[model samples]
Target: MSRARRLTASTTAYILIPILAAVSPLLVLPAITANHGASAWASVAIGQSIGTALATVVELGWGLNGPQRVARTSEKASLRWLTLSLQTKVIALIPASAVAAVAAAFLAPSDSLTSSLVACAMTASALTATWFFLGKGTPWLILATDGLPRLVCLALSAIFLVMGAPLMTYPVLGLLLPSALAPCLALYIAAKRAPLGTKLWWRARAVISALKLQSTALFARAASAVYIALPITLVSIASPSSVAAFAAGERLMRMGLAAVAVVPNAMQAWVGAPADRQSKWSRAKRAMAANAALGFISATIFGLAAPWAVTWVFSGVVTLDPISVWLFALAIFTICTSRGTGGIGLVALTRVRAIAVSAAAGACVGIPAILLGSAWGGVPGAVAGEILAELTVLSVQVVAIRRRLAAS
Candidate 1:
């Protein structure tokens, strides 16, 4: 199979997985609220947050480092870096699993004990599998390998939801089970197809060394977790209803942005090609313009239709204030614009360090804003914080690109 075909297939699968996974969760929100109440759900969300934060740190570090190494070194060296990242996840899982077990044993269980356990297990498994694929597989294969499990689980959850199963258990179990199983399967395949040749200890040390060298990425991951994940956390703190509201807005934004992501994703490969520098620049510019235009059209349409869309799609599950919905729509537009421009520039230039730095700056600006905003303004404040942070990062990225062009 051709690489382009493989990449296209993988991207499609990756996109579908999230969309499907979201379905069950989105469906069950109303039921969870009815059964467990907001506070219980909030507690569960907190536990999930811990797992998410850990996963984000590991995943983002790998993303930043892997691409940088790929740009700078041979594909073999890039594969080695990917292998090291997988090792890091496996090593981290040992500790994470221990913690999860202790939490399950000692901590007061939520409404869905089985679901929570499954969620934790799935988290670890998914992270491990994702890293493994990153190390050994082609990009498309890696994406598909990571995404397929989630998609399957999501399908199952949807079926269960229609059958009137416990809302909390079905969604969490569906999501988590696939996550756990995919990695185990991936590992088995990996072992059979391409067994590890290097000494385990040596591999571990190499990963650690890479991790140390990529401290900037580590910091970037940490900051990104705060920047992207904080809204979910804050919404939980504000109110379950708030979470539903913010989630509705964010979901719409995400769908639109996903469409816009095609350009940047394409630009990553174009930038790395051995073409004339001016050609690369022109390609990047065109991509940026196309993405920006798409973003504007999508945002405008979404903003105009948000009320009916929210009412029709999420009526029973979430009730979003018009103002809040509008803010979210606007924020989505800004984010897409920022991401489209920044993504093309960064990928084209292979500026991994700059991307990390920009993420860190955004996080620094966002976290405090979110905290203060949630304390003072609730959901509105959280939205404002996100917008401010994104703007700050976008401004920095724009300046950086301009400077690079000047130097060139």
Candidate 2:
């Protein structure tokens, strides 16, 4: 394939994977709400949100670290690094999954079984070498290994929803099963491609140390969880109906964000490649501009269409306040713009510490916003808080990028 064609295929695949993942849940939510109502839908959302946190834990820093390492490592060392990363993730998964399971049992006792299942699936999915494929700029491999199972599971979830099965089953099958299967599929494909360095598992601890050597990205991700999952956690405690509505809006916002992310994803190599500071800054600025434009466009569309979209999707069984929908959309836009300008740009510049500081600033803002917002106004307040948090983070990042580029 021509280089251009290859890039197109890779970007297309990256975009499709997240869309496919969202489609299953999006399609099922209407049914879930229609049959079981908002409360039940809320349960599933809470389960998935907790699962997301656990997945982040099992991922450690690999999602950020592995891709860069893969880009720089030689073919001979690639297998070793892959093996090492997987082992470290597995080591982390045991404890993290255990904690998630226990937390599920205690906090969501009504659906603990399904919550635990989803957690396990997330942990398994975390083991998949997605970063390797991303770094190699071969997104099609991810589509096959990750996206295909997601589709299969989506079909199954729809079938179960039609059969009037429990709401929890939808996420377990549609979300969790595919995730659990991804690592196995990745391994099968890797085995066919070349010999994997399985023997490196013994050096897992050292590998983990290497992974943590530059863990600013990990800290950033950890800190961002305040805005990412804390709201759902709080809403789950405040009101089940609100959780359902928030989840729906948040889901759509993420779909839009994922759609907007394709360009940035495709530009990672160019941005991260070894280059003079001026050249890197110029490319980064252009990429950030494109990303922010995409975000604005997505937010506008989301705000305009969200009411009709929500009503149609859930059969009017669940509806969020228009303000909440708008806030959620704004949050998505700010997140996309911040990540593009700050997250990806800093990684490319190797100014990862700035990323951590930016995330910390967001977290400091988010914790209070989420807590007070949920306490004050329920879902809308929580979302409004998130909006503030993301904007704060973005401001810090944009300033950091400017100073770093100017200093260099």
Candidate 3:
């Protein structure tokens, strides 16, 4: 197949996976939010927030570098690499999930068990085959192994919730099961397909070497996730009621982030392919432009429709302040753009270290803003912090892109 045609097909297929299957969690949320009390709802959000952030830590930044690494290797080599990545992530997961559970329990003391379970489940998603499939240019693996499980579980979770199942059922069926299962399934496939020798995947030397090499990406992706995810957790520290109001908006924004990821993700293989400097820059320009248009649309729709969406989804149990919603919407726009500039742009050019520096710069600005803002002005203030962080990452990336051009 021609390169352009292949990319177009791959992009369309990737986009469809999210549209058809991966959006299930969003569809199930109304049932969860309407049935649960506001505190329980907020507590669940806290777990997801902390869990997602720690999951990134467990992933060890492999998602940032794995696709490109695999794109350049043989199928057997790629499988072996995935095994190495998984072992390191497993080591990280032990510590990360523990921290998430502790923080989730402290924040949601009223609903500690469910909250901690949610946190642990989301953390376990570090094992997903997302990066491996993307590198192989096979979006179907995502649907078959990862998306389908999450979709089925989400449906079951919704039904169980409507029938008055305990709150823990959602996290278990909807999150924990799928999150851990996908990687196990991936590893099983790897074991069957790859001519992997008898070397132990759990060896300390291999895990430590992988960790050292990927440390920059680990720190970078983790730092960036802080601004994107942890705001609700931070808000919970101030007022549980405020968290409900903020959680709806945050959930909407997060779901939007998930939906829009197909763009940069689909483009990753294309951008990260071996190319001349100028051609690489051109690919990134097209990616950033496409993401900008999508970001604008996402922001406009989110800002205009969020008030009603939250009202209906929460069954009027949670009402949002407009200022907070719009700010979060703006953060959504910046984040989408940054995903192009930073997620694809920096990583594609083999500028992984630059991404780490930008992420650190963003976290330095974002975390404190969230910490102080949530305590001071509530959700709106916290969202403003996220916006600042996203913009900082974008600015640093644009500068890097420009420098790449000049040097070329």
Best candidate per lDDT, number?
A: 3
> For residues 37-142, could you state the per-residue lDDT of candidate 1 as single tens digits?
4444444454454445556665546654354235444444444555566666666666665555454333323544643553365446435444333323333454
Question: By TM-score, how accurate is candidate 2?
Answer: 0.90
Q: lDDT per residue, candidate 3, 1-408, as tens digits?
A: 899987677667798776754278665677777788787788898999999999889889999988878866776778778889988888899999999999999898468999999999999998997898888787767877888878888899989998999889988888888887899888776666666473425667877898999999999989877877787887787645578778878887877778777887887777767657667768878998999988999899889988887787777788888898889789878888888887788876778888888888898888888778778887787788778878888888889878876776
Task: Identify the candidate with maximal TM-score.
Answer: 3
* Candidate 2 structure quality by residue, lDDT tens digits, 303-388: 99888888877778667787888887788788878878765677767777787788789889987877777777877987888898
Candidate 2 residue spans exceeding 4 A from truth = 2-8, 194-201, 238-241, 274-278
List clashing residue pairs in candidate 2: none
Candidate 3 error regions (>4 Å): 1-12, 20-22, 191-203
Winner by lDDT between candidate 3 and candidate 2: 3
Give lDDT for model 1: 0.58
C-alpha TM-score for every candidate: 0.76, 0.90, 0.93
lDDT of all predictions = 0.58, 0.71, 0.82
Q: Ten consecutive residues with minimal summed lDDT in candidate 1?
A: 130-139
* C-alpha positional error of residue 87 in candidate 1 after TM-score superposition, expressed in Å: 0.8
